[model samples]
Target: MEWSVTNLACRRGQLRILEGVTFEVAAGEALILRGPNGAGKTTLLRCLAGLTPPLEGQINAPEDTIAYAAHADGLKAQLSVAENLAFWAAVFESDRAHAVETAIATFDLETLRDRRAGALSAGQKRRLSLARMVVTGRPIWVMDEPTVSLDVENVARFARAVEAHLARGGSALIATHIDLGLPTARVLDISPFTKLSGRQTDDPFEEAFE
Candidate 1:
């Protein structure tokens, strides 16, 4: 599936988070949304996922075709790893035994399948949230800081999972300060679009603290 955002703008209360943001993404292509804090990366991702609507613009996407993994792990924490996958499998897609098992193994969660999500460490919870994407099997993924708390090994694993998804013709829009190893990604810097006049600048992060 193909997704497009044209002159998208969003506001939270009186604050304008994003404005005049335009971009397009197609299957097998990934775009990295990069910028300093408060650059609206997560806000833009939320707009694309339909969690929040844009003030003035157009987003062409399939209904619920996008899977979103926010900064919060979004896991029940009370539910076991297997149970969490089961619940999402039932909610987002069909309740298929094989699919859940495949996702568990794909994210390397088999060892902690029966463990409660709350019992898992920060990194494992991130992995569990990512595994939800595998269960949904959707064409578009909007992930916000997906690699947070992950170590070197799991970060590599997450990169491989992204590669496999892209190889299978899926599209992704990832908002991150850390790299996800995308070699051919087009970078979109949303900092310039901020409505905060004092901070507006042509360069993505010029004068912005690193």
Candidate 2:
């Protein structure tokens, strides 16, 4: 599948944060978003994920094909790691047993499968949160700061998971400040699209790739 955004504009409340943002990610590819804080990376991802509507322009991707993972680890604190993934698999109407088992092993959560989410450490919780994304079977993963609390080892694990996903013809749009170790992923810096005080630029991409 190919994800394309053309002449995209995004806003937060009354303020417009980005405009004329355009990009495309083909199947088996990844795009890494980079920019200073408040540059609309999250807003753009939210717009693509259909969590927030674009202020203007079009996103050519089906809603059901995208899986979004935001900064918050959307996990029920009382639920066990395995239980959380199992619940998501069932919700997505996928192969619940296979999804749960695959996700557990993907994130190295097997040992912590029976432990409650609240009892896990920050890294563990982040891992579990990422595991949930796998159960959806959605091709496009929209992730925002996915490695928040992860250590070096866990970061590598996450990178491998992303690579494996791409190898399976899946695509991802990741917004993060740190390097994800994906050498082949294209970079989209959101600085040019950031809204300025008092006036909006007529052309946001004139210097976009510079």
Pairs of residues clashing in candidate 2 = none
The sequence of per-residue lDDT tens digits that candidate 2 reaches over residues 1-210 is 688999998765545778999889999999999998777887788778786689899998886999999888999999999999998998888899999999999999989999999999999999999999899999999999999999999999999999999999999999888888998999999898887433444565421311
Name the candidate that leads on TM-score.
Answer: 2
lDDT tens readout by residue for model 1, 105-150: 8889989999999999999999999999988878898898899999
TM-score of each: 0.90, 0.92
TM for candidate 1 is: 0.90
Candidate 1 worst ten-residue window by lDDT: 201-210
Model 1 ranges with Cα > 4 A deviation = 197-210
Q: Pick by lDDT: which candidate is best?
A: 2
